[model samples]
Target: MDAQTGSTASAFPPGFPWGGAIAANHAEGAYLTDGKRLDISDGFPRGIKHEYDAVIDPKKCYPTHEAIDFYHRYPEDLALMREMNFRAFRTSINWSRIFPNGDDDEPNEVGLQFYDSLFDEMRSRGMEPVVTLSHYETPIHLVG
Candidate 1:
C-alpha cells in the first residue's frame, strides 16, 4: 500500500545550509585601485582556457577587470544575496588587494577598510561571510 510504504525523500534536512560563492580572481574588480596591482589572475585571458603565454597578452579582454565588478558593487550584491536567503556568502580576499606587491612593509589601509565594510554589510543583513585568504589571487611578484 502506498500509504504503508514510507521512506525519506529528501537528501538533506529542512533549512539545510545553502549559499553562493566566488573566488577573488573570479569576481572582484579592484585589481588596480586602493594601492593594488597585478596578481597571477591578471594574466589569464577571458572566455576559454589557453596556454598561459598565449592569453597573457594585453590586447585581448581581461576577465578580472570587469568580473562582475563585485569590489565596487558588493553592498548591492550582498543585499541580493539576502534576497536569495543565502545562509552564507563565500568569496576570497585578493592577496594583492591587502598587501600590494605581496611584500610591502605595511598592508594597504584602503584595502583593509574595504573588507571591514564588506563583512559589516553581510552581518547587517543577517548573512554570514566566508572569506578566502588566497584563492588564486596571490600577488604575481611573490610568485616570480
Candidate 2:
C-alpha cells in the first residue's frame, strides 16, 4: 500500500466501482442548441462549483458551454474509458436537456436519444453507466 496516494489494490475482493465521472453541465455541451434551456450550471463561471444563483462572468470563457463536446464525442471517449478498464461510467443527465426548462409540456426526444445511445455504447463494452439525476444542473428556471 502506498502511503502517499493510498493505493489500495489488494484490499478489494472484486466488483469495485472503477468508474469515470462527468456532470451533465460539464460534459454534455449541446447547451440550449438542441432545444435545451438554461440550467443553473449554465451560469456557473467556475467549472467545478459556484453559488446556487451565481451570475455568469461574461468576460470569462464558459467551459461548460463546450465541455469537451461530449455530446458529440462519447464514442471515442467511451472507447478510451474501456481501454482504461473503467467498469462503470458515471454521468448526470442534464435535466434541462430533457425538459428544456424543468417543467415542460413533454420531454425532449433528442435529449432522450442521446442518453440511449450513450448507454447502449457502454453496455456494448460491458461497462455500466451510472446516471445522476441532478449534478448541480437543475434548470435555471426551477431555482425560484
Error of 1 at 142 (Å): 1.4
For each candidate, give its TM-score against the true structure.
0.85, 0.82
So what's the TM-score on candidate 2?
0.82
The positional error of residue 2 in candidate 2, measured at the CA in angstroms, is 14
- For residues 62-122, what per-residue lDDT tens digits would candidate 1 score against the true structure? 8887788888999889888889988888888888998989999999999999889888988
Sliding window of 10 residues with minimal summed lDDT for model 2: 46-55
Per-residue lDDT for 14-95 in model 2, tens only? Answer: 8987878988888878776778888877876654454433566667666678888999999999999999999999998889
Give candidate 2 regions above 4 Å deviation: 1-11, 46-59
Total clashing pairs for each candidate: 0, 0
RMSD of 2: 4.6
Runs in model 1 lying further than 4 Å from the true structure: 1-8, 53-57
Candidate lDDT (C-alpha), each: 0.82, 0.83
